[model samples]
Target: MKKIILLLTATLLSTGVFAQVKTPQPSPTSKIEQVIGLTDVTVSYSRPSMRERTVFGSLVPFGKLWRTGANENTKITFSDDVKINGSDLKKGTYAIFTKPTKENWEVIFYSDVNNWGTPQKWDDAKVALKTTAKVGTLPMKVETFTIMFSDFKMDSAKLNFIWESTEAMLDIEVPSKKIAEESIQKTLAGPTANDYYQAAVFYKETGKIDMAKEYIDKAVTMRKEPAFWYHRQQSLIYAEMGNKEKAIEAAKKSLELAEKAGNADYVKMNKDSLKEWGS
Candidate 1:
C-alpha cells in the first residue's frame, strides 16, 4: 500500500497539472507604436496608476533621475535614424531615463537597453542622446500614465508623456524631403515601355509632335510584344507628324491586334481613326 501511494504521487507530479492564482498588478506594461513619415517609432513601458497618491514631487521626486516607468527600464526604438530635440539620433533601441523639475524635464536616451528599474551605477558613457523638454500642466487629473504622438506632419511628430497633471513633449523629425526627391529622380530616369508610351500620348496631345514621335518609336522598340494600345498611340503620333501613309498602316496593325486580343474599345478606336484617315 505504501509503495502504491508513492507511485501515485510520483505520477501526479510528473503530469504537472496544478492550480494557478491570479493577481492584479499595481503597474501594467504597455507598448505604443507610431509611424512618422518613413520612420517607425516604438515605445515599451509600464504604467503605474495614480491610486490617489501624489506623483510628481512626492512618490516621484523632483530634480533626480527616475526610471520613467515601473518595473523594467522604459525603452524606445527607432527603425530609422531620426532627429530628436534638434539633434541627430541613430537607429536603435535605448533605455529612457528622465529628471523632472518645475521648469523643464531632462530626457536621457541611454545605449544600454537591458536593465531593471534603474541602473545599479549611472554611467555617463552609456548615454546616447540627451535633451530637455518644457513641462506643461493638464487641466484635469490623469488616472494612468500615457505616452502619445500628436501634431503630426509629413516629416515630424510630437511625442507626449503624460502622468498625473504634468505633460512633456519631444519633437521627432525624419528625413522625408531628401527621400522623396531621390525616389522621384530615380523613377523618372528609368522610364519603362509604358512610361514612354504614356509620355508620347501626352506630348502628342500638347502639340509637341516631334517629341511624341521620338517617344513612340522608343516605346515600340522596347516592347517584346507591343500591345494594341501602344500601336494606336503610335498611329496617332504618326498622324500628328503629317505622315498619313504611315498613320493608316499603323492603324490597320492596331485594329488587327485589338481584335485578336478581344479588346473591343481599342478595336473601335483604331477603326474610327482609320476611317477618318481615308484608309
Candidate 2:
C-alpha cells in the first residue's frame, strides 16, 4: 500500500512538472511570398501592434539600427538577382535592418540572418546593400506593422513598410525581359542532339521506322562527340529499315566506342546483335 501511494505521488509530481498553459503571443509571426516578374520574393517577420504608443522618434528612436520587426530577425529572400534603387543585390536571404531619420530612412540588407533580434556586435562588413527611402505619412493611423508589395509590374515592384502613420517604399527590379528573351531564343534555335535522339527513340518504340531512321541519322550527325548509345540506337533503326550494310557499320562503331568507354553491357549487346545480323 505504501509503495502504491509513493508511485501515485511521483506520477502526480511528474504531471505537474510537464503541465503547460497556452497563451497568445504578444507579437504574431507573418510570412509573405510574392512573385515579382520572374523572381520569387519572400519576407518573414513578427508584427507588433502600436497599442496607442508613439512609434517613430520615440519607441523605435532615431539614428539607430532597428531590427525592422519584433522577435526574430526580419528576413527577405530573392530567387533571382535584383536591383534596389539602381544598386545590384545578389540572390539570397538577408536580414533587413533600418536607420530612421525624420525625413529619410536608410534600409540595409545584412548578409548574416541568424539572430534573436539583433546581433550583439554590429559588423559593417556584413552589410550587403544599403539604400535610402524617403518617409511618407499616411492619412489615417495604422494599428499594426506591415510589409507589403505594391505597384507591381512585369520587371519591377515596390516594397512598402508601414507602421503607425509612417510609410517607406523600396523600388525593386528583376531581369524578367532578359530571362524571357533567353528562353525564346533557345526555343527558336531548333532541336538539340539529345532532342533528336529522344525523338528517334520515341518513334522507334511507336513503330515509326522511317521517322526513326531520319531522326537517328540527324542525332548521329549533330553530336559533337561520338556516343556509344547513339550509335547503338542508329544500328537498331537501320536494321529496322532493312538496311543491313548500314546496320553492320553502325554496330561495329558502337562496339568500338563501348569497349573504349569500358561499358561491358553495351559491348555485349552490340556483339549479340552483330552475330544475329550475320555480321
Candidate 3:
C-alpha cells in the first residue's frame, strides 16, 4: 500500500514539474539595411550564437551549400545596374548563397531567392557569378549576418558579404559624368544632364557656383532645354572676365532662369551685381 502511495506521489510530482517546464525558443533574427550611393541594399537573415564545438565541419559540413545565413535565405537588391566583380549585373534582387570547402568557398548568386536549398540543376540562377575566398588562419567566426560596402568612393564601391571564415566581393559603379553626357545625346539633348543653363541659375541661387557649373554642363548637353541658364552662366563668365556689358547681358539671362525656377536669391544677387557694374 505504502509503495503504491509513493509511486502515485512520484507520478504526480513528475507531471507537475513537466507541466511547469517550457522549452526555450530562438531569439529573433536581425535585419540589415544599407545604401551604397544610389544603390539601396538590404540583407535579411537569422543567426544563432555558435561555439567552436557547435559549428563548422560538425554543425555545418565541408564542401556543402550553406543557405549563406540561417532561417530565411540571404537576399540582396540593387536599385540600379551595377558591376559585381567587374561583371555587369542588371538591377534586381538575388539570394546570396555559398558552397563551403576545406580551404575555400564557392560564392553564388541565385536568381530564385525563395527556395530553401540549392537544387542540383542551376538553370534557375540566370546571372550567377562565381568567386572564391579562402579561410582565415585565426579561425574567425560570425554569429550574426553582415553586409557592407568597402572601398567606398564618390562613384564606386566594393560590396562585401562576409561571415565565418569566408568572404565574397563585387565591384559596383555609378553613372559617370560621361555617361550622363551620353545620356543627354542619346535622348537627343534635353534640359536634363550636363547642361549649364537653368542649372547654373540653380547653382547661383543655391550658393554653389561650382556645382551649378558642373550640373549646368549636364543640362546643356541635353539640348532644347532653357538656354537662359547657359546665357546666365555666360554672364557670370563675362563678369569674371571684366567685361561689364557682356556680364550684364549674361546676368539678365541668369535672372530669367532663376525666375523661372522660382529662385528668389539668384534674382536678388544678380540684380545687386548689375547695379554695382552700372555704378
Task: Name the top TM-score candidate.
Answer: 2
Q: What is the lDDT of residue 7 in candidate 1?
A: 100
Please give each candidate's TM-score: 0.63, 0.74, 0.49
lDDT per residue as tens, model 2, 92-145: 999999998889899999999998888999999999999998689999988999
Residue 17 displacement in candidate 2 (angstroms) = 8.8
lDDT of 1 by residue, 46-149 (tens): 99988999999888899998999899999999988899999999999999999998788999999997889889988999999999987999999999988889
Error of 2 at 246 (Å): 7.3
User: What overall lDDT, based on C-alpha atoms, would model 3 receive against the true structure?
Assistant: 0.66
Candidate 1 lDDT at 168 equals 90
RMSD of each: 13.0, 4.5, 14.0
> What lDDT would each prediction earn against the true structure?
0.90, 0.95, 0.66
RMSD, candidate 1, Å? 13.0
Per-residue lDDT for 54 in model 3?
48
Judge candidate 2 at residue 272 and give its lDDT. Answer: 96
Candidate 1 lDDT (Cα, whole model)?
0.90
lDDT of 3 at 8: 100
